[model samples]
Target: VRVLRPLIDEAGYIEAIEDPNAIVITDTLANVDRIVAIATTFDGEAEMDAEVIRFTYAEAGTVATAISEVLGAAGTGARLSVDASSNVLLVRGTQRDISQIRSLARAMDTSPRVAQSETVSTSIYRLQFGEASIVADLVRNTLTGSTDLTNPVAASVGEDPANPDTKIFAVGPEAAPISPVSVQASIETNSVIVRGTQRQLSEVSQLIKALDVRRPQVMIEAAIVEVSGDIAERLGVQLGIGENSQTGGIAATSFGNGGGALQNILVALGQSNAAALSTGLSVGLASDNFGALIQALNTSTSANLLSTPSVTTMDNQSATIVVGQNVPFRTGRVTTDGGNVTEVIKREDVGITMVVKPRITAGGVVQLEIEQEVSSLTNQAVTGAADLVTNRRVINTTVLAENGGTVVLGGLITDDRLQSNQKVPLLGDVPVVGHLFKSRSDSRNKRTLFVFLRPTIMLTRADLEKAAETRYRRAQSAETAVQPRSILKQEKVRKLPLEIDGLY
Candidate 1:
């Protein structure tokens, strides 16, 4: 009624009747036609229509309220309603009113608000080959330009007293601007949640790609060899004298009186002289004159291949191989209150063991940190207990070598010598005759140990296959060399006859 009252008054209508859904106007046809024409032309609503405008980004109720206020102030007979559930505006008006409402909605409905100075977005990145916590820390440091997690502000910005240009102001007119970035790790899911701007998130994603890659593997081969040699000689002469005597009595008796008359006795005494000479020589010579002697006692050369262990591990990872047994030794004894003793026994590995950590560099060079040990049980006695003793030779060092190239890590050379002479106190000093009364012995032993190591970087499947083939060939050769002899020939031999030629 309010919207149509002005038009009716200007057209001089006689009377008006209002109804729930319609309105009646009593006036001249001429005045009615004028009023209709003016209403249609001025309001641009020749016929009533309805439109539903669904909001994409803006709230429907808010937009509807604003449009309703504008229509009321402008005195336009347009009704607007909002459907909060569907986020739409329902307008009952002509085409012009609906069009205007759509324009207003478009202008108000935009993307979510973003701050100019501090805008943060959340993103999650899943890791394939890298640790979540470590990657998170790396991302945080890289995005924030700070290495120190405890104090990021102090670490990122610094001041120098001597240089005027190196001063950084935190709260002054010349203060530096810093961007905000935060990163957190979800270890259970193996992912990292980063909160930062689009630019920072992009950088974090790139860094993660570079860091999360498959690690290269290294195959290590070790050889433990022991060489030993021994030589000994002895020369001596001995002489002595001996005396012997024997006495015996024989009695033939028929009775006590007859035995006393027929008694016989026998006695013997003898003197004898003995002499002995001994000489021993051990040398590495092949001559017919001393072939027998040299074969009996000669310089012996022996080589012992203790162990050859091979292991594969990732770069910067530690791998260990033990080719022996663990032996228990008594370390201490404790007496209990009831006079019972308890011995504390510790088991130690007594054999060849090698532990290596290899790191491959960019230029096919391997850096190795190695610990090699060779331990064995010895006959040397322990003073306080019956526990056996052990001799351990260990080498702990680090070196660099080319990939697939063998390098000698370390070596040990040991020399042992012993000499002894024994004789009668004054006879040993008798120049030429001393040899006859003296004995002499000499012994010498030498041993050498060398450790060789080779590292092969396995970066691809082909490399791994090649290394495996090599190891297989080596093991096959070793197995063939130590194969047992055949007993089939011995089984074919016939046994000798038990009663051959009636000799039984």
Candidate 2:
């Protein structure tokens, strides 16, 4: 029992975390002129009992998907090994091919060495349930009001009697207490966690997918300046994106292939594919614009916030950060009460509450109403309320330049518009469509009914069972089973926008 404590501890996780899943695909097919070639490969056998998985987490979306044309184009063997719960193809099939997946990683005017690997995954979790039949069972239990999600220790189960998921294992050595993903009360008033429900997580995943598809398409309207030799170095991404985000790719290319050459290459971006390009790009602490973006976020977004903005300017690169929140009223652009300048601040209506209603049951209705302290609420007549209006959502800005080049601006956002509900597609290349997802309900205080909103992903009980099975087998087979990293739920200003572009 003592030997298996660690593995057993993970058994408590019932669902996947509601977070953006970023992938950095390596470009192995880019030529000197920066034209990338995308190839495709095939699998070992035909699609038979393919799973109908959601790749994310929650309920009903965890099974493997069926083999179809929509999935065939992404890769070869990956199309066949479709476990919907995990959304990625871990298949063993034909040789490596790179035909249908390349994209614009750099400017077309010069040969950019920037490249990405073929990424084939969406976020999903591998869990071990003590005796729950399937993920669908838990979903039904949560939906039907039979399970008390507030008490993770309670047996909130579904109606189905005989459904099981991927990760299941017979009783084994006693393990450590496993902790599941959860959304607890935070210190921030406007901040609401996208958590608990399967649907919420799925929606957040789909929103990321949408942003992934749109960022590259957005045309960069910055004034294009003419630079002579070795200019790509001058076009430094200023956004404080971390080394793991969009700019990360540029830095890696700068180091991997050669630095100065990338600067000389020309980069042309269109609004249509800006989201897609952002997926592969990694803008990090190296840039300046990122710092500015952080300073712009005024709406009280998180509790662990650095109230006093951090401003640091070193050498040619500079970062200025100023963070404040205009709560109980809609925040507007910063304007000073001065007679020397034109209208700098905008006006706004004031209120102090966020109402959330959950559409969970097939036909049932769930209503949740929450309001801040009355002292926090103020009418339009209140001070500073008239000076707040929404013009732009650019918060947390950073400006960057490297090796003597023109500077640029980059920022991060607190209230994200891209995250929504849809079961993310698995590893199949076919035209991937998201599944139906929703956030979980907060039924802890039986005396009061409130819909606790958070990012959610769906998974079937079968998927959990399978994940348990995977973990159990690995534990038994290898000298030490490699446990998946745990996802923590917290929010802080993004120091490096590039880091947001995650690398697996």
Candidate 3:
């Protein structure tokens, strides 16, 4: 609700019907009045400054109409989000109507979410990962273009980044006198002629291949709910949100694992509920106080991270809940060779750490320590990658742990709706590799080396490239937002239409 603070401060609210007997207590609520007065002054100053603003009014009639329009517009907007961090009140429209978005803020009696100099960074988790990228077209023309590369004899080759270029550089065959790449440098005059380097030729071939028509295509997608900067940054130093802005700045100074840590995140989480967008889902990690995105940006490997709920819903059905898996610490991975092949959902379970301090590696891997409520499902050795995390198909595995999940990665995949206190095995969905990890209710029970015993997640470059090549077959399932569209394979070439002298 937009309120002309000056008018609002002077007028207060005309309470249902104006009372003739009541003293003209127009200037009431001292704190509110001060805020309104300052804001009112700023509003007037803005008009003189000619700042473009949608017209608004604080009167009842105007308020009603404006709300109708805003809600109506929001109905058509791609996504609408409201975030409150510290003093910043962020209202996002969509790609369609940023310029013309009008909010009924002025008509609102409550404190306006937005104020002047409201410094709010986008909810790109700017601190977690520190780079940003946007696909830009060439200066005046599209960059993806045609290229002509020649092989020893005349060859009008089709564009292929892996093939050798004919015009600028000559590419020797895989089986040539250049077999031993280090020996032939003494042959050419004006230009240096070094041979036997298939690797070098291969790289050059790849660039020449990229030169032809295909800009980095961006895929638009729905934005996910993310934690705010203030919270993500805190997840770094303290466990369970040690020092944060829940109790304003005071809570942070008294940082510890007890109530202090949870207090920061819970408060910030309650207040934040942040939202933003990108062409494709991206992770922007910014250094402390980095103004905006800098270089050193690479595509973030998409993790199944979710935070907020979608707003599109009606009465009668159900409420939407959003949750994000947080990984405040560094991360490592151990994969079961999930090549392009889809891993079957053999079985499912949620591993709940019945105890606190379930021992997460410093590299951000959580091992839920659950009480031995039930014996092992299978007789496999309850250790190593061979072991499995027990799973029970349920939500919010509840075991009264210190903190269910991290603010950076996400909370435990536990359910709050579980019957309390009765012994519950850590829920495990997978038939294998569950259980053996149990912890106290609070996470501060024990401290393990943060970076120790981190496992590497391996996928051969060839395997990954092959996976990327075949992605188009199941394009619908690819995490295209973070991954690239190039993952979609190009049309297969049947034969190398090379005409003898000039390979076409």
On lDDT, the leading prediction is: 1
Candidates by lDDT, descending order: 1, 3, 2
On TM-score, the stronger of 1 and 2 is 1
lDDT of 2 by residue, 229-327 (tens): 222122233121123433333442222222222222212111132222222211322232222222222121211112221121211222222223353
Give the C-alpha miss distance for residue 305 in model 2, angstroms. 17
Model 3 Cα lDDT, one tens digit per residue, 342-377 = 333333222221111233333433333222111113
TM-score of each: 0.49, 0.14, 0.16
Mark the regions of model 3 whose C-alpha exceeds 4 Å error after superposition.
1-247, 250-311, 315-389, 392-504
Better of 1 and 3 by lDDT: 1
lDDT of each: 0.61, 0.26, 0.28
The global Cα lDDT (0 to 1) of model 1 is 0.61
